[model samples]
Target: MGMMFPTSLIGLSFDRFWKLKCLSSMGFQSLTSLEYLWIKSCPSLTSFPEGGLPSLLLHLSIEGCQKLEKVCKRDKGKEWSKFANIPCVEINGKFIYDPDSHSD
Candidate 1:
């Protein structure tokens, strides 16, 4: 978590956000209250943080992120499971991965 916020942050969106090359492993694992996250037009983005995202996150969308290759691996990496319970996940205007269906 690069910056600590009050335990009340519910939604966050990054539109055309530049300068940051990556969003993962920046301490998002500490955002216990975060429910929604939207990232758009971040062309420089490449991948997620190694530690993974917060557990409370329910919604995630990534659009126009041309450089972003993979949002965590399919079912191997530690960060992969962090997104396993999310209800909605959209990438580039398409609903590709479904985390809930991979549950145990």
Candidate 2:
């Protein structure tokens, strides 16, 4: 994804990208209208983009990406800052950040 995704896109998913390793922050930031993103089965992925995910991102789902999940475990994660603001986040079917359970 090189800032070429349709701006009208609101949801996106990355599935079974076995060779995918990392993504560029700027590339995702350009998705100004993006709301939800899901990634699965990319075992080699270990990190998020450099700066952070788009502020408009409302939901995030990650599965089967053990290395990346380990690096994004709530506040203790090295990439926590990138996900702290997303209202919804699910890792391996676990709710890491759930708006329904969050209190102020």
Candidate 3:
């Protein structure tokens, strides 16, 4: 969980990154090409970076993050809008929020 790589990283997945508490503000921001991201079982992760997720992220799934409350406030803003175009999002084995389903 404490590593850095090229900014060209297209896809990243963190499975059982136990020690990661809070994601860096610039973590996903710099990964402009990141499309798929999956995080699982990082029990210490309480929340997301204040800046929000990457703009090009198409798929995101997180599970077993018991401390996490919300990805972002449910509202019209930069943080919320980041997920507006995402095709798929799943949390804790369930799809809590879906753009296609909520559009109606």
Q: For candidate 3, give the lDDT of residue 27.
A: 64
lDDT of 2 by residue, 5-87 (tens): 77778998999888888977767866889899999999989888898888899999999998898888778889889879998
State the C-alpha lDDT per candidate: 0.70, 0.84, 0.69
For candidate 1, write residues 1-104 as lDDT tens digits: 26756667989888987766877554576678999989898887776666667778888888887666354445563445657678777776555465553433
The regions of model 2 sitting more than 4 angstroms off are 1-3, 98-104
**Model 2, backbone clash pairs (residues 3+ apart or across chains), number:** 0
- Candidate whose TM-score is highest: 2
Q: If scored against the real structure, what TM-score would every candidate get?
A: 0.72, 0.87, 0.72
Tens digits of lDDT, candidate 3, 1-104: 44566789888888887888877766666788888888899888776666767778888877887665354333533345545567677666555475543331
**Model 1 quality (TM-score):** 0.72
Q: Is candidate 1 or 2 superior in TM-score?
A: 2
How does candidate 3 fare on TM-score?
Answer: 0.72
Between candidates 2 and 3, the one scoring higher on TM-score is 2
Off by more than 4 A, model 1: 69-82, 97-104
